[model samples]
Target: MAKILVLYYSSYGHVEQLANAVAEGARAGGASVVDIKRVPETVPEQVAKNAHFKLEQSAPVATVADLEQYHAIVVGTPTRYGRMSSQMAAFLDQTGGLWARGAFNGKVGAAFTSTATQHGGQEQTLFSVIANLLHFGMIIVGLPYSHAGQMSVTEIVGGSPYGASTIAAGDGSRQPTEIDLAGARHQGELVAKTAVRLFG
Candidate 1:
């Protein structure tokens, strides 16, 4: 049974939704196990007391041991100022010990993200996640242009040649479009299949 870790940092729920879609795709492609982990919030003390702000639901904190048990890892994040959120970055930074030990060497890696606007730096966020995988010597996988949604014309709202994505409306209440969901699933399946081929 191959296990894939779906790890992410999401604010306003968009990225979490994308992560779920990615996991669904991985499962559809016959991955035996999928674990979803969320990075913890890190708001300043002054802002923590604000009524408008609330602590994000924290997923299980991933340890170096956790990385060792997985055949592949799929990372997701919301776009933050043309980059991945600092929480996600901090999570990756904690993996320095794993990198030093070559714990992820040759393992499969993939990324996904969501943005508040159509042009809100989804690609940059994906690449930012990919960069950390590279440091760990993990092979990066991405959604191919061959996916059906990629060729469709009905407003491709999410996913890309880089990885999975979603475009939340300005108000942040809009769910991902069906096309976006399909693309995310495709990305998950592709990464799972690649991991199986490479490591199984």
Candidate 2:
């Protein structure tokens, strides 16, 4: 019974939708406990409201200590200039204590993200998240080629061997397509399966 946490920070609900899909796949992959949580928003309340940020998210705010309880942590965030959003980075930065004690040394870690365009640095954002997981001594799980959907050239899709991703469009109108959500699910399931085999 592996415990998996789908941790994410979504500014426009794009990544949130993918987070939920990831949780669903984790459950299907035999993880008994799958929790979806979001990091705290660092932007000022007024600024967030003015920017029309999605403030009505339902996931509870995750604390640094929460990372200790999961066998695997699947992270999601929106891309900001070829990297992860500052909100997600700030939250992960607080995990220095966990790194010092190797609290996550044997855990499985995976990443997912959303971008504003096809070439909006989705892979770079995933690498940024994976880099943090590596520093924590956690094993990295990417959206592997086994997903198959990542190779599709039929439609405008968001996925890669690095991780699952979605194009949110410049105006924040385009939502994640079905293929994007499927890739996220595949990555989450793989992460959970790896954790179960390694930790259980």
Candidate 3:
């Protein structure tokens, strides 16, 4: 059995939905333990509320030390200017000690993200998060072509060979679609399965 952690930073709740789907998939993929947690919010509560951010997230905030306890870690974030949000970046930046210790070495790592538009650099954001995981000496896993839903032409969905994603509208009115959530689940399942094979 693999222990998996779904860690994410969601400003408008879209990534949070994907995080939950990822956890669900990990459970279905034979993981004995799956925990979903969110990174700390960098913005002040008043600012977040003024900006209409989803402030009442249910997942407990995770600390840098938490990364050491998981066999696999799946990260999710929203794209900010074709990169990861500062909140997520700030949280990951604190992992330098873990990097030096190789605490996550040889573990499974995967990334997922959301963008405000179809051309909003979803893949770039995924890479940004994956790059941090690489620095932690993790084995990278990506959303593969086997999840054929990414090829759908019927809808404006988000999923790439880099990772699963969803296109949240610019006004933050759009939520993840079924296809987007499925892609997140597929990536999570793959991550968990890979961890089981590597660690078990």
In the range 89-200, model 2's lDDT, one tens digit per residue, is 9999998888899899878999999999999999999999999999888899998898887788888889989889999999999999888899988988898889889877
Total clashing pairs in model 2: 0
Q: If scored against the real structure, what TM-score would every candidate get?
A: 0.90, 0.98, 0.98
* Candidate 1, 1-200: lDDT as tens digits: 77899988876777777788888999888788888887767767467556333355546656556777898999998888888899888878888777888889999999999888878899998899898888889899998986668566667477788898888877777888788888888889988888777766
Screening candidate 2 with a backbone cut-off below 3 angstroms (N, C-alpha, C), the clashing residue pairs are: none
Report the C-alpha lDDT of model 3 over 100-141, residue by residue, as the tens digit: 888999999999999989999998999999889898889999
Candidate 2: what lDDT? 0.92
Question: 83 in model 3: Cα distance from truth in Å?
Answer: 0.7
Report every candidate's CA lDDT. 0.82, 0.92, 0.93
TM-score between candidate 2 and the true structure = 0.98
Question: Which residue segments of model 3 deviate by more than 4 Å?
Answer: none
Ranking by lDDT: 3, 2, 1
Candidate 1 residues lying further than 4 Å off, grouped into runs, are: 44-59, 151-153
Clashing pairs in 1: none
Q: State the displacement of the C-alpha of residue 126, model 3, in Å, after optimal TM-score superposition.
A: 0.6
